[model samples]
Target: MNQDAIEVRGLTKRFGRRTAVEDLSFGVARGSIVGLLGPNGAGKSTTLRAIVGLLRPTAGDCLIDGAPFSALENPATHVGVHMDGFGFETGITARRHLEIIRLAAGAPPGRVDEVLEEVGLADDAGRRVKAFSTGMAQRLGLAAALIGSPRTLILDEPANGLDPDGIRWLRRFLRGFVERGGTVLVSSHQLAELEQVVDEVIVIKRRALFAGRLDDLIRNDVDSLESRYFDLVEGAQA
Candidate 1:
């Protein structure tokens, strides 16, 4: 992995008097899959929003490829994002939705079809989102993220409603994405699934608690991701 594909330097965000995140800092290595782990109310969503320019941090900044997200010439070409609220138009067909996003991203005309197939939704492209299942909606969100053909992906709960088979497919897809020279920073509550694919891990609770490789974090203690995660989250409360 190249040095600091993404860098968050002293990030802080606040809503009026309440602090959401404070002095958080970390780096996502290029061409690597990093899992951002934290329990609910940990400010994970706030941090991701700041990173993608959806919201401004009260202090510090997030840089993608050594430049702040807003500084990127064409952001869609460099960073792809799929967060909690995907805002899919339930009334529209999947293909139409993706085509709209592809146009907005300045992607090629055929890009929508490419992503549809990539996310295993080729046959359902013409189906309206309202008729789809939760798992299918998640897939559509992912397809929207890839429509830009970005080098880096930031996904939140990408496997939210997937079944065992779907989860397995997501794991393989994420690994394959990184192997193809893409970088990923994904947040998921599914520690078991996240553990299977991530090369590095970043755990946070309001601020950065830990950031490093999974192997180093566990150190062969028989305990692994979940154990370390509980330790980290619990420690933060102490």
Candidate 2:
């Protein structure tokens, strides 16, 4: 049996009177890449934030290898996270930014260059973050998340700013990572791109909407993946 790498049980989050997520539960199997899909304000980010311990859940829990993320002895080595709003000081060079994180995370300093190379940012390492393009910034965030060589990755909209070539590279990278026993839970609104990377998907609209293999969501008819996804999410809200 495949072990669960990440598990969210009855996860809920609220901000004042607004309930962001409600009793959301799902799991990403070890060595598999799972997609978190939903429309805007559909609790996708909330769930990811809760999983990474960035936000406190009003109810329920998220676990990595059966333990809360905060409880990990060395969180960096166990899990790497890249969520929305992650930023770097504009004046800092990409190398410096990662060096700071490497120091804090107890990762080897040399790993910074390795990750930059991994993310196709090695040549741009000396450039200030403010000077990088949106796609480059996204690549930097990914490089930071990968610095620790964690077993699991939790990312939100990882392909947000990638160009066609960069997006293609990311797809191959994610697949290679999982083939080596790494697990990933990535969120994205790009259904076609997402479909190319994820083995399974867990969708939500302020609650658990759908959870299963991606093939299950695809119908034999002419309706595209986007069309099918909208239908599912819309049906849940109705």
Name the top TM-score candidate.
1
Candidate 1 residue-wise lDDT, 1-238, digit = tens = 4668799999999999989899999999998999999999898999999999899999998999999998998788889999887688889999999989988899999899899999999999999999999999999999999988899999999998899999999999989999999999999999988888999999999988899998888888588899999999998862
- Which candidate number would show the highest lDDT if scored against the true structure? 1
Model 2 scores worst on lDDT over the 10 consecutive residues at: 217-226
Per-residue lDDT over 122-224 for candidate 2, one digit per residue giving the tens place of the 0 to 100 score: 9999999999998999899999999899999888888888899999999999999999889999998889998778899887898877898887877676766
Tell me how far the alpha carbon of residue 159 in candidate 2 is from the true structure, in angstroms, after superposition: 1.1
Q: How far is candidate 2 from the true structure (C-alpha RMSD, Å)?
A: 1.3
Q: State TM-scores per candidate.
A: 0.97, 0.96
> Which stretches of model 2 miss by more than 4 angstroms?
219-223
lDDT of 2 at 124: 95
Q: Candidate 2, after superposition: displacement of residue 121 in Å?
A: 1.1
